[model samples]
Target: MPKTILILGASYAGTATAHYALKHTIPSLPDPSSFEVVLVAPSRHALCRPATPRALLSDDFFDQDKLFIDVEQQFKQYGERFRFVHGRATRLDTEGRVVSVELVKDAGEGEVTLEVAYHALIIATGSSTPSPLHGLNSSGRDELRAHWTAFRAALPSAKTIVIAGGGPAGIETAGELGEYLNGRAGWFSSKLENPKVKLTVVSREEKILPLLRPSIAQTAEGFLAKVGVDVIRGVSVDSVSPPDGGRGEGGSLTAKTEVKLSNGQTLAADLYIPAYGTIPNTGFVPEGLRAENGRVETNPQTLRVEKAGERVYAVGDASNYARPAVHLIMEVIPVLAANIKRDLLRAAGESPSGEDRVFKEDKREMQFVPIGRSKGVGAAMGFRVPSLLVWLIKGRDYFVSMAGKMWNGQHWAKET
Candidate 1:
């Protein structure tokens, strides 16, 4: 029997790790065919989340087929070396090296329980946001697609759309909506326009993009203003009241939903999107291995699960090493993969070359906030990056063109 290198989550982190193990780690082993990689995730497709902001606007740049890449197809070339399990992890036993999974069944059918034992475990389940429009959360691809359809169907008639959250998702979403719907001449042209809609972004923080430098945040605010998005700061959404009629036409309660702010003000919105409160998908993780915030307690340097055995590892949003960001995810992948490969080599009674990779947290401020299609603000390595460069790098289609490369493991690392 082949030893199973089990990975939880099929998002960018998990998928990249599996590819690295297959292409690099396994090949380095004396008995190459002695191991196989198994990936477990809820959805068969992996969502290209960066493009979601524009995707909400139903942009031709973000086609559903292109945004959601089939996970199974991405690994088809690996053949017997890779196995994709369509399920969600329910429990993890680090000591026993076993994981309890709930296999997704067909519509209207109950989920089937499955127990998988692994020689090594990697947790990359990532995080979830309040709205599926921002993150995949626990919803399957089909369900998420339906959500997009319903949201778009309601957009035409929605006169007022309020987005709550000052984070990247909220700001980006507001920018996309504002520019597409309310932007006048001289702004990036949009094929689909809805000028009747009023877009507002409500942030509990005093300034948006709280993680970025104050100047960068201020620049973002200015960009949003130019795109006709209203930024409401220092107020939180205290309560939300669903429409009394429930499920209005086109499956939206937009016409009647009411949002109460912390400042003792209420606003009736045709569409209310809550983009805050992102929780890591670490429910199945052992309590001892998890931090107070529900993220796995990972050793910042080694990328290993703190308090867990050396064979256990974590990366991406599920790990508490650093704040969740796409660039951070990419940075941690090679470190985690190299460490796992070294450990696996030792277990195989072979001496591995080079020292174990360590992940040093970059203290320099690095962020890119794209306000609209034509403009953005960013900083890298403690220096402010030009807006045009930011737009060219990320704002243009939100890197939708790289979805295929990401899925195929081409983005995992630079080619040797």
Candidate 2:
């Protein structure tokens, strides 16, 4: 008899797990129909979240459709072996091994819920930061497109822009805005007067990009300074005033806001964007499996949901496994898939000693900070790459071109 595997979330981690499972389990099974994999997500699109910071700037560089890849079509080659449900998982009963999902539909009707049973489950719901600057919307493509369109229309008249966080997303957004208003560095191509736009970045920490080494952090600060962006460290936002009025036909909102800071200061701007940290999407998970901050607590060795036993696992930002990154997901998927195969083989009365696997943290120091299309700084495998190289590698296209290939293939698979 075939066993069912239900995977929650259809982003990088979820998608990768599904692909690897098919590769490892299907070919080995005498009856290929003995295994089924089902993926459930709020939307059928695997949104390119890393590109959202740059994409929101304008439509000229980002084609909205490119950010959203159709997940169903991508898995069509598998036929009934794979299934994708366009809905959000609202509840879960780990003991019963059943998940309740709310189906998303275009037709105007009441909500519909479905209960799905699984012999094994993977939770990869991923995390989300504040919107309009942090990440792209996943409800649908139309909602995401509408957000970018409105921001671009309002930008020309937005003389003052205030960003509330100094993380990667905030920094990238600051850089893109700086380049859009003023031309390339050391080039005064624009005839506009001095202070074409007042841009400010507020960081609660003592330094911006605090995760990077001091020298590397300095390099990022230097790039922002060269591009005319004000980097203010050790300050936090206290309150933000509401918009004065609604948006006009041109998609520009009439009212700007006054932002109050912890340093006893106030700054007004045409737009106030929050780029704070990410919050784990673990609400659907059981309380016993969650941490104080709402992140799933998983076994460090096996990556299984703690106390929930070996048949269930959690990965990506939603789990307390370091932090979220595309590379991190790439590293986790294969180990998780191998472990699942080992457990399944054991259930089928086969030897499991050589099949079980463990996950270890990848300590390689890797980070690429691109300010705009032309320049950036990075450290790859502990070696500092030149800014020009960073521009060529990631700053130019925001790596959206490579994301699709990375998601659909097993470029990081490892043999245990």
Candidate 3:
């Protein structure tokens, strides 16, 4: 008779929680089988979101659903201790401990409430990548991938390229295309159908990577420069529209909308890509919950959405525990799992004389960042491991194989 814990969103944070709890944390607690862990997500597989860039050049990467992870298979080694639900959550009641989960299929979704009551809940819906890639598509597994596929199809023929938003996504897209076009940073030894493809990044901010320290930000800017990316900083656009009534291809109907800059400048391209920012996907959380900046805001240390009365938590992009970073998920999810078990211990009246084990003051630290696939920057395990580690950790195969290994003998588990 284990208490149930329902986890939402099954990407990095959610996946890590399930794996850690099922394999490590839960077993460490008393009567592990008494604490059933249930994971709910939109899909059955965990997608390797970072590799969407490589998929642009390599057709072998286009196995769209192939990259997805099977949660059941991923955690099967844990036996009947875990359950995965494929559905979209409609609402949550942290107070009463109930979640309204909707089972979505091809044509329609079947609605139902979970039978078990939760001793704790983990929301790890993660972030999506759109302009800033702040949504489901931003993970580089969705619309952005589709957009790149379309852009690459026309690349060999296009003469100009204009990218909006100077964030990492914008820079990454520019870098990859430049590499593909010239074959090298050196124009001398390269094969290019067009060496003069106009690449411009428009950002309203005075500098790029605003969240990063100025020095580190400049380092990124320099990297972009080395790759021959033209960055346009501090210029906003009033509206986005095509001039001369759309040229080439299918115009607005088939192609992206032309942009009109606020500086009274008209910029058009064979392809227009938006690398904007992220917004919260808490619409599924119903009402009365605290969500801000298009994301749910919670105390970093506690991970409590508003009050800490019930067993509740949010992780990854869906919950803005103050700052958002992919690497943070690595740190936060483990802390989150530990905290949940601690809460369960306290709730079961199994605490050690008023000492609270459930606390959430985890620090936010970024360890690795890969620019493209081969090169980038980062610091890991407290060594500032350099960009080379980034290449190995994420740049190489985009950690697709590592993700499989995390599942303990399934997925890309054997591919490596």
Model 3: lDDT of residue 384: 47
* lDDT tens digits by residue: candidate 3, 1-416: 56877788887778777777776667767777788889887766677666655555555744554455566777777678888887767777666777777764544655555544677888777665543222243232344445445556666776666777766666666666665554435435222333467667788888865644455556656555555557788887556655322222233312545677778887876666656665565776655565647666666776766652477888887886846665566656555766666777777677734433343433433444455556665544434446676778776676666665554433212211
Clashes of each: 1, 1, 20
Error of 2 at 191 (Å): 17
TM-score of each: 0.92, 0.91, 0.79
The alpha-carbon RMSD values of the candidates against the true structure, listed in the order shown, are: 3.4, 3.3, 5.3
**Residue-level lDDT tens digits of model 1 in 34-126:** 899999999888888888888866747677777888899989889999999989999998788889999988879986988998988999999
lDDT to native, each model: 0.81, 0.75, 0.62
Candidate 2 C-alpha error for residue 47, in Å: 1.7
Candidate 1's displacement at residue 124, Å, is 0.6
Q: Which stretches of candidate 3 lie over 4 Å from their true place?
A: 28-31, 60-67, 107-117, 131-151, 187-196, 213-216, 226-228, 242-254, 352-394, 407-416
Candidate 1: how large is its RMSD?
3.4
| Candidate with the greatest TM-score versus the true structure | 1
